[model samples]
Target: MEETEAATEKAKDLIRMGVARAALLEPQDKVEVDVVPSALIIGGGIAGMTGALNLANRGFEVTLVEKEEELGGLLRYLHRIYPTQEEASDLVKAKARKIRENGNIEVLTSAIVTQVQGFFGNYDVTVKREGKDIPFKVGVIIVATGAEEFKPVGLYGYNGVNIVTQLELEVMLKAESFTRNNVVMIQCVGARDDNRNYCSRVCCMTALNNALILKERNPKAQIFVLYRDMQTYGTLFEDIYRKAREEGIVFINYSPQRLPTLDKGFVNVFDEFLGEEISLLYDLIVLSTPMIPHPDSGELAKMLKVPIDEYGFFLEAHVKLRPLDFATDGVYLCGSAHWPSTVSESIVQAYGAASRASIPMSKRRVIAEPIASVVDEEKCIGCGLCEMICPFKAIRVEEKPGGRIASTIIASCKGCGVCGAACPQQAITMRHFKDEQLLAEVMALAEGT
Candidate 1:
């Protein structure tokens, strides 16, 4: 009886504190902003073209920009695709044709985004083309700027002639002039090392596909693949891997500590299974290098005010919840810009990004959540700390007639409470999570209410 009475008194005290705190708290207001109803896609690769077609087909205008003179990015250079063994050029051409025929889609070649301003559902983008600036408004932007193959120039004594990269090997295969009977392929050339530390994802399959092609070309050709690990993960890829082995292609696993040494006409490696060093004469050596982020990725990330990982790939908002979106609401990402991906994977991601971006434009308005950062002009000292600390650049210090003051772009604020925590003068507060409201909840829990 005594313990119950004490608990009741504690609960009563917490209820009183909660009531007082609730009285001081105020509800936040919601803002509705108009959307532009258009999108900007920054790439003309398979991913970008697919995204553009999807958006245009759905009745949304799309501006597809490419840095190169034509569309088809890296797919244009490939001779054939894996698993099904389809002609890569035909696939790229079909997609390009669809994008070109779509009236709602505007294709811009040899163009680059010079500037980006405004916020979600209302962005002002400027593109540079032929010594001119083309400015336009867009509801959202998708970055599909694909990656480039890592040039393994000096590593493993790569000479680009006999010792060529997988991409270069594709060119030789396309020309049908690769008449090397004794061929050797080295995997993970500049990847999974101390410098890169990534798998490259597609190198193993590419090497296997090319190896099978060579075997088909020359029945008695001796082809050897030296790999760290075979990543034939999917069902189709696994089937091809088995087929390569059945066709008498030799696969040898090597350790990073015992990498293959390349010479003019011979390659030496320590075979892990055989537990012995082996030297084989080769007419051609192909290095399966990784795909790295483009050189312009940094500049583009800065211009869009989005985050990129340490390796320079664009960082998405969340790994699961918002895989196609950036922390900035108006921006989306797909293809190798996010990571090294195959053509099919890039197309899937592009479609996902396009669908995600179309939501606001289709709605034609943005209803901002009530929870956001609010500024207290009286306590603000214009220190600019909040402005600098904001990842989304949601806060800015403006010069008024009286003095300088910090202001929040309500639409741009993600309600992350970053500015509130960074403010030294206690001038910023996050609505719906203010001090009084949080304290009331805390006291309520403490009293077991």
Candidate 2:
């Protein structure tokens, strides 16, 4: 009888504890906010236009802004595209035509985003056009500001005459002014070096493609390509590479230690395969450099409150899961703004960004997830520790009548819980994962319930 009483008392205690713990769990209500079905796409380049057209096709209004007076960024300067040898002008013209025809898209040229405020689902944007600041309310933003080509000026003794960049050479090719019988192209001129340790992904292919073009123009032109490594990974580019080899173009493997030296229409280099230093006389020396981030990328990133990589390219939310998105919700990235990309890759990324931006617009309302950070006013000491630790800048210390307190912007809080973990007074708590709720789970596990 005594044993039975003791066991029953223990059972009662466990039940009481479980009930008390269960009572501490407070269910949070979902916040529903009206969403604006409009998007702001920065940059009127190929990616920007493609993303705008795609969103407009989905019945969403779009605002496309360009820093330049016209559309077609780098594409406007290119003579022809690689592998297919298609005229870049034709492609840009078609995309521009579609953008102009799209009634839902409002194109803004010679405009810059002066200010950006608000959060996901609703953003207040200010554009400076002709010294006037125009306001725009948008649901999402896509950053497609393209990058600029690196100009290898002093490197390799580039003088814009004998040693010219690939872009300059493209212009000469278009004008039919490059009638040089002997030409030497140097790949990875301003890239894959100590300063820039990234391979210009397309420089090798560009050299080969342009070499083939030169061969087509003059069958007897002596063309040579000096490269560290050929990055013709794609099958189409590889096919072109093979065709270039078959067309009697010489490809020499060169090392950085023995980079080609230029002296008045002559280039000297040590060929790795031949194991000998050789000098060649050429009329033109084309330096195939990489595409770098735009000079204004930092300023743009600051305005958008987005993070950029060390190389000044906008950092995506995730490498695989959210390549088109920023960590901040409602903001997306595409094109060379993210990284140096080819035309096809830029177009694909633009469409992906458009699709992602259309999600909240399709739902017609933005639903806040219940998992968010909550503040306990009584325990808060107004130390501002939580505010300082928050990476999203979601928490702010406000001065109230009684004392200062840390307040959380629930819509901006991503439930990362860094603020809660960093709170000295333990005043900040993450919803659905409060201390009492977590302790209850621990107690349950301990009792083997």
Candidate 3:
């Protein structure tokens, strides 16, 4: 389709910028870019990288900015991705190679977007990279920051003793052989209860993977995975479930209705299935907790004007049709930054998201919205209320020759016209509404005057 071809061309453009950025970076700067990006992909994780690469393929110049010291996100910590159990690092390395080959994508590690303004088709993003701030004029934005695991320290006594998280287990699996002959894994330690109701999709699967590995390591090992439900949907995954049972792995039905207790050397869980209470002894306890969004998600959502679900995941406009795209036309969301997903799922989403970003490049460039806020120079009072109230931090509050003041930076303004609403002196008039034009509408809506 025409859309697909256009996407490819822009993808190439962004990749060229990537090489340029790498060469010009300063000593502390992990990466640098001078290009006015066609789209900005934030988070640099699986979703971010996939979005960047796919957008590059579509011929969009993409700037991938990550807050972490390196990329790969959660995939870096995993020993192997499940179902396939493929080497996680090898997969990440391969993606890194493709990212290098793509000439249209530029990467910035250890970078944080401090200020973002503009809307849909045109936005100004200010980022801090290596202690220096940089700004970019972008046509689109994609958020793929991903999620972090929760520490159920109290529930499972996971104080780094025998109690550990799925990630910690991965590390221990590689470091030293666990002495526990009987390992009991508890699922949903911090998810899908009254607090977090959404199923994390991958926790059950991850627990299964770990249990199977533990059993494989020691044929005499007793691996028990306790869960409310075992959701092994999709083709071939059912086979994985069957294999786990064949390997002598035991699964017990647990309840989120009551809190699970951990004693000195055993787990005291009610036998909801057997209609009684029971205690299971184990040397190690793995808490397969659900992933939670970063605590700053609320602030980030407000700053970017992005919508988030009540539970904290970035809420996408349409679950299927828009996949990575937000309800807002030019914004996109990806990975655990939005919701939980496996590396394979995240990578697929990354591709879908980045591919969607090629729209701006099809036109070669974008035009600024004319509906931005405007100051009436003569009537304007330099109180500087608009500058500070802007969530995007786009306003430039400046003093004039006298005590009088004025403001500028229209491109950074989203044309939301919240400033005009906030202005007390009524000196600011947003485009499309003049003084008389506003009065007529207000009067029409108002009760008879």
Q: Which candidate is the best by TM-score?
A: 1
Candidate 1 per-residue lDDT, tens place, 348-378, comes to: 9999999999999989999876788999999
TM-score of 3: 0.77
Angstrom error of the Cα, residue 220, model 3: value is 3.3
RMSD of 1: 3.2
lDDT of 3 by residue, 48-127 (tens): 87778788877778788888888888888887788787877888788888998888888889988898875545577899
Q: Number of clashing residue pairs in every model?
A: 0, 0, 23
lDDT of each prediction vs. the true structure? 0.90, 0.87, 0.76
Q: Predict model 2's lDDT versus the native.
A: 0.87
Candidate 1 backbone collisions, by pair: none
TM-score of 1: 0.91
278-390, model 2: which lDDT tens digit per residue?
Answer: 88889888999999999899998877768998889899989989899898888999999999888888999999999999998899788776788989999999999887767
Candidate with the greatest lDDT versus the true structure: 1
State in Å the error of residue 104, model 3.
4.0
lDDT of 1: 0.90
- Which order, best to worst by TM-score? 1, 2, 3
